[model samples]
Target: MTTFTALTTLDGKAPAEALGAAMEGLDPAPTGVGVFEMEDGSGLWEVGGYFDAAPDEVALALLAAAHGARPFAVSQLPEVDWVAHVKRELAPVEAGRFFVHGSHDADKLPEGRVGLLIEAAMAFGTGHHGTTLGCLRAFDRLLGAGIAPRNVADIGCGTAVLAMAAARCLPDAQIIASDIDPVAIEVAEANLAANAMAGAVTCVTAAGFEADPLARRAPFDLVFANILKGPLIDLAPAVADHTAPGGHVILSGLLTHQAEEVGAAYARCGFNPVASDEIVDWTTLVLTKSG
Candidate 1:
């Protein structure tokens, strides 16, 4: 079946989210709505909605005007199996000792490296992104340096790939992974099972460390947060508070320009910078908590 989409962009996250929320009451009513900040350093956020029928342009215009967003661009999308398309485009990714791939590329997995099977679905973090790869490499570097955390948490884990990698390295470690969206948690669970870590890593539906499971496992020896700059900055203190003294942290999902500010944020929270790896347009930072 053909689907319609209405999309617009504006400054600030509040307006974008407001526009997304407003789209829910439209005459055609969207089947899904999303608001995301663009990573092109434009400080702009995009709000989009999917619909089963044609949307009223007048309603869209009014909503855009109210939210101070750009004029809505509506278009019909041809029916395409996006999952199959994603599978076709995704090849295996190797970062340090970690290997991420779909079942079709199982033969490509290196014999001695840690293998994580991540199906090509709507979820994110297949280890192909510079941010995810940088994070994995950071972990491997730390491991190589004889630093292994017994308790680890992957905040905003898209597919739980990082958590699974840690689990593979430290069989006895207490590992937890979480995301704000339940759908992401579902994807994480499936990926965990594919990696033979079904119940090894606890998957929680949460934003940051709000879930009871995370709070109980406080003072983690390591934490992985591969989220965007805004949340990374906001999470600095909380991440520092939950991390044990002398613990390590791997942070990514940031543009190279934003790395300094994010690093400063964590530095203020007693997380001293250890090392940073820049890959393409993104940079990942590894830090250690000051005792």
Candidate 2:
């Protein structure tokens, strides 16, 4: 069946989310809705909805006007096997000791390197993105320096690839992966199973460190957060609180220019910058909490 989509862009997150929420009440209500900040540094948030059938153009127009968003662009998408398409286009990505690949490339797992199976699905962090790549490399560097964290948390984990990497390297470490989106948590669980690392890492749905599971496991020795700049900045204090003194945090999902500000935010929360790796337009930061 063909899918219909309506998309619009607005200036801020609140308005964009408001618009997405309104879309759910439409006459031909959307099956799903999404509100995401445009990654092009335009400061614009894109609100989109997917419908099994065509949505009411009039309702969409009114909602867009009400939310001060651009006029909704409605279109019908042809049915396609997105997973197969993605697998064909996405080659295995190698970052330091980690090799991220889809199931189709299972035979290509390199010799002696850690392999993480992450199929392209409704989540993020395939290691193809610069942010994910940089984070993996940063973590590898920490390992090279004799860092053996006994407790690890991956905040906003999309597919739990980072957490899985930790699990592969630190077999005895206690690891938990959390994301605000339930769908991402589901994907993370699936990926964990695909890697045959099921039950090796706990998965939870929570925003940042707000989940009880995370709070209960506090004072983590290492944390991985590859989220956007806004959320990353807001999470600094919470991350610092959950991390033990002298603990390490690997952060990414930042444009190169935004790295300085994000680093400064963590620094104010008692974190000292240890390393920064820039790849293309993205940068990954590694910081140590002050003892």
Model 1, range 1-291, lDDT digits (tens) per residue?
Answer: 889999999999887888899899999899999999998778999999999999999999999999999999999999999889888999889898888898888988888988888888743889889999999999999999998799999999988889999999999899999999899899888888777788999999999999999999999999999999999999998998899999999999999999999999999999899999999999999999999
Assess every candidate by TM-score. 0.96, 0.96
lDDT of each: 0.92, 0.93
Error of 1 at 166 (Å): 0.6
Please give the TM-score that candidate 2 achieves against the real structure.
Answer: 0.96
lDDT score for candidate 1 against the true structure: 0.92
**Residue lDDT tens for model 2, 54-147:** 8999989888898899999999998898887898889999998899988888899989999999876632689989999999999999999999
Kindly report which residue stretches of model 2 are placed more than 4 angstroms away from their true locations once superposed.
Answer: none
Clashing pairs in 1: none
Per-model tally of clashing residue pairs: 0, 0
Candidate 2 backbone collisions, by pair: none
